[model samples]
Target chain A: MKTITSTVMLASLFAVSANTSAATLDEVVGKGHVQCGVSQGLPGFSNFDDKGNWSGVDVDICRAIAAAIFNDSEAVKYTPLSSKERFTALQSGEIDVLSRNTTWTATRDTALGLNFAGVNYYDGQGFMVRKDLGVNSALELDGAAICTQTGTTTELNVADYFRSNDMAYTVVAYEKSDEVVAAYDSGRCDVYTTDQSGLYAQRIKLKDVSAHKVLPEVISKEPLGPVVRQGDDQWFNLVKWSLYCMINAEEMGITSQNIKSKMNGKDPAVKRLLGEEGAFGENLGVSPTWCGNIVAQVGNYGESFARHLSVDPLNISRGVNELWSKGGIQYAPPIR
Target chain B: MAKEESAGPPEVTTKPWNDPKVRSIFFQVVLLILVVLAGMYIFGNTADNLERQGIATGFSFFGTTAGFGIITHLIEYNEASSYGRAFAVGLLNTLLVAFCGIIAATILGVVIGISRLSKNWMVSRMAMVYIETFRNIPLLLQIFFWYFAVLRALPQPKNSVNFLDSIFINSRGIYMPSAIYEDGFSLVLWALGIAVVAVVVMTRWAHKRQDQTGQQFHTIYYSIALLIGLPLLAFTVTGFPLSWEIPALKGFNFAGGTVIIPEFVALWLSLSIYTASFIAEIVRAGIQAVSHGQTEAAHALGIKAGPTLQLVILPQALRVIIPPLSSQFLNLTKNSSLATAIAYPELVSVFTGTVLNQTGQAVEIISVTMAVYLSISLGISAMMNWYNAKMALVER
Candidate 1:
């Protein structure tokens, strides 16, 4: 009887440890797909089309990571998560990488046991109001009812903005971005505040998009990026370098169309980035042609921006997201 | 008592290992041990994983500043308040909706339930249609219909549908006049208190007098007169000390008066309407459970129809109704959590949704939210149980 009880206890211990012992890359490799957490639908970020295809800058990050690992951009499964559910989903290993439009903050980094891989998009909080409301600026929004998505840094930023101005306002927050837009469009709120890019994204969903205008005021800096669970250094480095590879490729004037011809080119930086020289891919434990795959499949950062945000409906200019050599703030460390 | 000789102890037919009582006890003990072991394993495993993930696990985060604004709060709340205060604000909002919903549902349910059994064919059919239309549809859809389809279709604040220039109904909310009291308000309050006490004493005296002399008193009429007359008299003497602050469109919304946010209105209306349908069926069943003979007997005694229902049938029917009615009340309270979908700022929406995200304390926040709902449900259950026992039939 004693021996039987001991055996049962040992078996149960194994079961407990089995659930918690995931090394994200190995698990992703074993499953043959990268599990990516993204937003429900933010037009230029991570949105699902009617054809069941997801496309955006954030979605491309996950695709880039998958391309680097499996050399197949489509080997990625997406889980659309709300802002309220995103952190828990990542912390519980429900997704290997959260490429949602998540702002990297100090408290989230240290306290939530998560690490920001790198900033994929630089953004700032701003407001959108009805052009008919005759409100030209955010400071004029005193006593205005504001609608925002809940469980975001936007709420805290708006609260601080109003309190410091000694203005009184009411916030009607919703859990989903769609609800916020619906509420704002129905006149439940006088002002809609979110990341400036998000405001533009959501504005397209409005009934009369021409009737609304985004305010000029940029309230706070929002460095949106991908996040991974803490304590997995290998997974963290892989994700970080995957994003850097895209930015580096953009800075080198390398386009997806030219990447095939550049395989035998002579430039040292191009050779190194395209995996012809050095042990960059071997160091990260991926294929030597990993960077080549990412550029060929998902394209460089500039290509993605032009494809998603800088085009027709969004019409966003690359004021700050341009490469560091091109008077914008985007900079990447050189890979030896 | 009859004297009897004590018999010796009964003999055991089999060994203790083969005895049924010993076997049952052994099995129960083993089952208990297994249950405890499983529970401990789950707890330990969760803790281990959480620690490894580096997610903070504690209630200390409650004291941290919440730094968020709520659309509506019964108590004072601001960005400066702690997460604990936010929890209370959410709890109070939930209770406000649940309490108002319970009262509204019960009144509407009792009316519709009786209407279904009315002698008039049209009234009974309409009530049946009402019950079927509402109960058959899902509650969330009803809430969306009311919130998005009905309320959202209303005009904005600038073109609010005004009622007498004192009350404004718009897509934002219903804004009405709020009373601003002067110094002599206390005198009016005292007078109102005295009137209530006098009415209670008069009711008891009337009951006792009727028991002794077999005569009835118009106690309700007297109580109403006292309640209204005393307050009005106090008001006149105090020179009409109350002034009204009517809401006017100041900026984006109406300001300077009591405003009811549309989220609350939408949630309350949907929950009450949905729960009332179920309650109507329960109430109808309860009334039918009372025999037709009881009504006949009351009529045979020359009692009027209203009096028959008030005095004879309802008193007995309540024994059946109260038990199920309590369950409906509990359901309404729990269903209020769905307010999160519509942004009502209730307990689950404000605390569990926002606070959990801000603090990243899912383990602690979720458990606290669950405990709060459990306690609220238990409190409702205990109150209903007490009332049920009081109204229960007493037999000698």
Candidate 2:
């Protein structure tokens, strides 16, 4: 009986897949909205307001993509997904693009049959302990109980760190970041470990924010970026180059307010990038003013970074995220 | 009847193979075939799409090195380990939580369930309040509350709350004494094994003698005697083998003992409390299902209230209760999947979420997880059904 039911289910799934294969791109374009996957809630990364308006660093990328395609930033729908559901949603075409704080790994890129457009943030796993514990360094946490989120790369890093250091520590694993923070705060865990950026975000939420300090040791590299499903080359190019345009704009000193003036500038590379010459957008099946539309609608990479995640109020520095010319890792290919 | 039979035989109207019933079956078979064909066609297209994109399909990745990390696990794991081993660790962690939660829930649930029906008003009200409070709220919220609001408020390890000079509680986790084994531990284990075997044999002998001689033997007392006697003899023969490793404060945190993380405590406590409410309802219904007259009848037969309940009411009530009770148990098992929300490293969190993403084997990993859950549910149901059949009233 179970087999029979499963067979029926399999049949239904096939019918849906066949129906979807005809023209997925047309369907997305015709609908006038790109369904972009995002994180549930990560304050400055991807969070929704009480009015249901979505805004974040990742949110701006989705908006930028939409602007490049439809010439309107609002022509996008956000699908907030947990870490577990994000891939499946992308695989099933529930979302046109995934702009969540997803890490770019070989297994995810090749094994999951997905393509990462480009790296947006170069992050690493780190530990956060209460200041009163007097543990100034990750090495000082030899026998400490660590609160960690399960189903993440952070989990394995914790185990590896402890084992390599020849220190025995108990692990209090949770599924969500919030719970990991809660457990750590409740005196259930000696330390809370995750991405350094996440540690900064969560530390502020502690009852006594002054009491906790994020340790200096970075255990592993986590290059987080946007992604799209494999097999759609045109759509992939459109998203990939959109991010490149932002980075290039930042490098070439292009801002939203000065993009029009910069279009008539002397530099041939800048002219080609600002769509003053050549037809690069036509190759990606977009209008000639696609890059112009993206910059105008969502601002350049620096603007987006400052507006959402700068060191002003959120206090997030552009340490590794700064442009390559500025001693950072964000280098983009030439528009020409 | 003769006229009808003659007419039908003449026309061969009752052709069993061509009858409407048979045709209906045939139609269903054809429909099933069409459906299966359509399904296969879609699956083939997807495979082709994946192939064109150079994406390898199948479970072969399970044998590959994970090259990934995990936060907490009972067994040893490394980035160099096979995905299969990582999966095993995930399964073990899930089973560990489920096993612990089941025992805790059962004990707490039975106590609360009985209390709801107690004569003491405050006790019943308290149980009622507990049921209403925990059952209505979502499990995820409770986990967050426990982890963030409750556990995160703990004192630092240096100022950990000490109790009885053996246990320590702080933001890190609860530290408790673990039993250490000495040279005599082997003798103590053997003695315990012998005691268990002796008790079983004595109970069988007592039952047989009672049947043969029409004389009742206090089997419980005899069994208890054998169980204790063998163990005591062994302990006397060999010096006590077990020692205690009382947890003590080291440089900062408690060292040399077992630690129970607050995440585990929160998950376990929340699950037990939430599930106990439903279990209480089942217990109440099971008790109510039994006829009240059976108690009176048992009383007439010289059975006391406790014995009457044990002998007459419970056996029958259990028949109705077992089916639903099994479902509740299955519910608890499935609900444990929510442990992922709190980073419990259950099957869903480890295998499906992390491993699948790390390996990019969504289809294979999800299928494996679904199969594991299906088998667990089926296994529990099968066990319950067997017990039900054995205890069913036999009527001639």
Writing each residue's lDDT as its tens digit, candidate 2 over A1-336 gives: 123223333443344364235444566788899899998777778888899899888898899888988989999899987675676677666788899888887767886668999987888999998787788888888767777765577777787887788776766666556656766776766788888877887777788988888888999999888998787788888889999998898888888989878877799888778777899988878888888888888899999888888753368899999998989999888888
- What C-alpha lDDT does candidate 1 achieve relative to the native structure? 0.89
lDDT of 2 at B6: 80
lDDT of 2 by residue, B1-396 (tens): 346658675755667675677878999999999999988976687676556544567888789887555555688986678889889888887777777877777778777776887779999999899888888998778866775665646777777798987888886668888998888778867878987887778778888998899787787887777778877878778877677898877755678777776657777887777787888777767877788788778999998977776778778877877788778778777777777766666677777766765665555566688799889889878987998898887887
Cα lDDT of model 1 by residue, A207-289, tens digit: 99999999999999999999998988889999999999999999998889899888899999999999999999998989999
Which runs of model 1 end up more than 4 angstroms from their true locations?
A: A1-20, B1-16
Proportion of true contacts reproduced by candidate 1: 0.63
Once model 2 is optimally superposed onto the true structure by TM-score, how far is the C-alpha of residue B54 displaced, in angstroms?
A: 3.9
lDDT of 1 by residue, B144-247 (tens): 88889866788898999999999999988999999999989999999999999999999999999999998999999999999999999999999989999999
- Model 1 clashes, total count: 0
